[model samples]
Target chain A: MKKVLIAGASLTKVGDHWNKSLLDLAVEAGSAALKDAGIAIPDQIVVGNMFSGFSSLQENLGAIIADSLMLQGTPALKVESSGASGAMACNVADSIIRSGQANSVLVIGVEKMRDMEPNDAVHAASLGESASFTQFFGISQTAMCALLTHLYMQEFEISRDELSVFPVIAHKNAVPAEHAQFRKAITITDVSRSMPVSDPLRLLDCAPVGDGAAAVVLCSENGQTKNAEAEISASAASTDSLNFFQRDDMFDFTATRRALAKALAFAGLSIKDIDFAEINDSYSSVAALSVEALGFSKRGEGVRDAKEGKFDLNGKIPISTFGGLKGRGNPIGATGVYQIVEAYRQLTGTAGANQVKNAKTGLLHNMGGIDSSAAVHILRRVG
Target chain B: MSIAYWRERNRYYRILGSKCKECSAEFFPPVYKCRKCNSEKLAEQEMPKEGKVMAYTLSRDIITGFEDQEPMIIGLIELQNGVKMVAQIADASADQLAVGDKVKAVFRRVSVNGEAGQIFYGYKFVKIDK
Candidate 1:
C-alpha cells in the first residue's frame, strides 16, 4: 500500500458567509490548500458536500470546482455521505493514492448554509436520515438525536445538566481557536439554561450551523509536494442502520466502533497512543455516544469522564482540541475536513494555544445522521 | 408532493410492517431482510396497534413542512411483537406523558400540500388512557 501524506491543509472561518457563495468558499479554500502544498496543479480533485441541491439548487460540483480553480481537464468528482462527506472524501483520496490512480489529490469539503431559512436548513441537513420512516412526519435529525438523548439519559439515569459537560469542554477549547465560530467560553449552567430546541437538547447542546470550507492535499511518495510532516496512518469507514432507533442498541455506536477498531488495527496502535481526538460532537448526546464508541470512555460514562477533566487538554486523551463540531462550528460536510486540518495543525506543532502537548498521534471521528454512517482516521506526526 | 407518497399507502394506512418467515421476528416501517436471523424470506405483517413508549421528545426545531405541527411530541415505541418504531404522539401533552405509558397506532392525516393539494395520511400514536 502507498503512504498518503498531508501535503497541505486550510479552512475558512465558520460562520454566516452571506458574502460568499458555495463555489466561492470552495475556490478560496482550494486555492489556499494548493498554495500550502506548493503545487501548481494536482493529479486529481475530489469535493465533498451535502445539500447543494436543496440549499443552492446546484449540482455537478466536481467539474464546477475544477473549472473555478482554473485547473480544467483534471479529473474531479464529488463524494458525499451527509455530515461525513469531508472524511469520506479524504478516504476516497487515500484510496486513489493507494490504487496508484493519482499521486496527489485535492480534497475539499464545503457548505453554504446561511442562504436558506432555518427550517429549510434543518430539513436539508436532516436528509441524512430516513425520508419515509423518519422525516415523512416532519422528524428533524435533531429530533432523532433528541429521541436518542432521552433513551440514553433514561437508560443511563443521567440528568440533562450532566450531559452539558461535552459542550462546555468544546467551547473552552474553541476559545483560542482562530477559525472557531463560538470562540467565547461557555459554562455548564450556560449550556443547561440555553433555550431548548428539542426536549433535553438545549440550543447550546447542538452544534451551530454555518457556511465554511476546508481543504486538504493528499500526496503519495511519487507526488511533488513540500513542507509536509504528517501521514494518514490509517483510514476506515463503516455503516449502521440508516435509522438510529433501528439499531439493536441505541447507545452503542456500532458504526463508529467498527470503523475506529478497524482504523486502529490498520495503524498498529492502541487507543492509548492517540494524544488527542477530534470528536463529532454535533450534539451533547452524540458527543457522549461518540466517545463511548471510541473506547475513550466506557458506556454511559463519557460525560462523567469529561466533568472529571479526563478529556481536558492537560488530561489523558484530550478531545475536540479546537472545539470540534460544537465549538469550532459545523458546516455539515466541511466539518470533517476541518477536523483533518486541525489534526494536521496539531501534528505540525502549529496549533498555537489549543495544542495538546507532544501530540504525536491523533484520531478523528466523523459521522453522518445518528452514527448511521461513520469514518475514522488516524494521523501520525513525522520528523 | 403527495404523488410521491402514493406508493406507501399500505405502509402508512395500516401500520403494515414485515416479519421474518424464518425466525418469526417482526419489524416496523418494514425491512428488506430479517434483522434477527438474516433471512430474506419475509412476509408482510400488520403490527400490533399497541405498545409502550420507550422514549419521547418535544421538538421545537420542527422541519420545514412541519411548522404547523409546532413543538411536536415524537416517541420511540416498541410494538407488542418487539419491533420498534418512531411515530408522532397525538392528543397528549408532555406533562401527561411518561416513559412506559401505553400507546396505540391510529390512522391520522399526516400532511397537506396546500389549499388544493392531496391530503397525506399515516399512522400516529395516541396515549391509551387507563
Candidate 2:
C-alpha cells in the first residue's frame, strides 16, 4: 500500500459561531488548507459531520460544501460515525489515496452545534448511542458517562480529586492554544465545585459544545506538497457494543484498545515510541479509559498517572498537547480532525507553546459514543 | 419513536430478553446471538425483576420529552440471573440510593414522543426497603 502524507492543515477557533453558518465554516477551513498546500483543487472531497440536518436543517453536505468552495465536479462524500466522523473521514481519504484511486484528497470535519437549543443539542448528541435501547429511556449521554465515572471510581478506588486532574491538565494546556475554545486555565477545585450536569460529572468534566471546522490535505507519499512534513504511518478503526452496559466490563474501552494496537502494529512501533498524543477526552473519565486502553498506562492507572504528572507536556508520553476535547472544545464530528491537525502541528514544530521538544512521532485517538466506534491513526515526522 | 417502542413492548414492559437455548445463558435488552457460546439458537426469556444497583447517576440536563423529569436518577442493575440492564431509578432520592442496594423492577411511563405523541412505558426500578 502507498503511504499517505498530510500536506497541509487548518482550523477555526472553536466557540459559538453565531455569525457563521455551517457551510461558511467548512469553506473557510477547506480553503485555508488548500491554500496552505498551494493546490487549486483536490482530486476528491470528504466531509465528516454528525448532525448538520438536525442542527442546521442541512443535508447533502458534501455537494453543498464543494459547491460553495467552487470545487465543483469533484467526487465528494460525507462519512458519519458519531464523534469519530472526523477521523473516519480521514481514514477514508487515506484509503482513497493509498489505493491509487485519488492522488490528492481534501478531508474536512465540520459541525454547527451552537445553532440549536440546549435540549435539542443534547438530544442530537445522544443519537450517537442506541436509539431503541439507550435513548428510549430519556437518559442523556452525560448521564451515561456519569454512571461510568461512578463505576470507575468504585472499581479502582480512585478519588474524585484524582479524576479531576484530567480536566485541569487539559485547561492548562489549552491556555497556550490560540485555536482552543477554553483558553483560560481552570483549577481542580473549579472542576470539583462546578454545577452537576450529572452527579459525579460536573459541568467542567465534559467537553463544551461549540461550532468549528478542521481540514487536512492528504496526498500519496510521492505527491507531497511543499509544506508536507508528516506521513500517516498507520490508520485503523474498531467497534464495540453500542450500549456501554452491554459490554462485559463497562470500564474497558475495547474499541480504543483494539484500534490503537492495530495502528501501532501497522506502524511497526510501540506505545513507548509515541512522543506526543491527541486523545479523545470528550469526558474526563473517557480520557482516563482511553489512555489505559492505548497502553500509555496500566489498567486502572490512567487517572492516577495524570495526577502524578505523567501526562504533562514535559512528562513521559505527553497527551492532549493542544487542549483536548475538554479544553479544545468538542465540535462532535469535527473533534477527530482537530486531533489530527493538532498532531500534524506537533510533529512539524508548528505547535508553538504547546510543542513537545524533539517530537518525532504522534498518535491520535478519536471515538464515537463512549468507545462504541473508534479510529486510531499513527503519524511520524518526514523530512 | 412510537412504532419502534411498540414493536419491542414486551421487552420493555416485562423485561423480556434473550436466553441462549444451547447454554441457557440469559441477557437483557436481548441479543442477536449468544454472547457466551456464540450460538444463534436463542429463545425469549423474561428476566428476573429483582436486582442490585451496580452504579447510578442523577442527570439534571434533561433530554427532549424529559424536561419535566429533570434530576432523573438512572442505574445499572445486575439481575438475579446475572443479566445487567440500565433503567431509571423511580421514587428514590440520592440520599436513599447506594451501590449494592436491592431493587425491583416496576412498570412506568418512560417518556412521550412530543406534546401530542404517544407515551412510551417501560420497566423502571425502585429500591426495596430493607
On DockQ, the candidate that comes out on top is 1
Across A1-383, the per-residue lDDT of candidate 1 in tens digits comes to 88899999899999998899999999999999999999779999999898898899988999999999999999999899999999999999989998999989999999999999999999988999888887788989998899889889988988878999999999999999999999999999999999989889999999998999999999998895674699999999999998887777889999999999999999999998999999999999999999999999999998899989999988899999999999999999898899999999999999999989999999999999899899999999977
Chain A TM-scores, one per candidate?
0.99, 0.98
Going through the candidates in order, their DockQ values are: 0.85, 0.78
TM-score of chain B of 1: 0.95
- Poorest 10 consecutive residues of model 1 chain A by lDDT? A219-228
- Please give me the total number of clashing residue pairs in predicted model 1: 0
Query: What does candidate 2's lDDT look like per residue over A183-206, in tens digits?
Result: 999988999899889889999999
- Tell me the docking grade of candidate 2: medium
Worst lDDT run of 10 residues, candidate 2 chain A, spans A220-229
Q: DockQ score of candidate 2? A: 0.78
List per-prediction Cα lDDT, in the order shown. 0.92, 0.91
Those runs of model 2 whose alpha carbons end farther than 4 Å from true positions after fitting are none
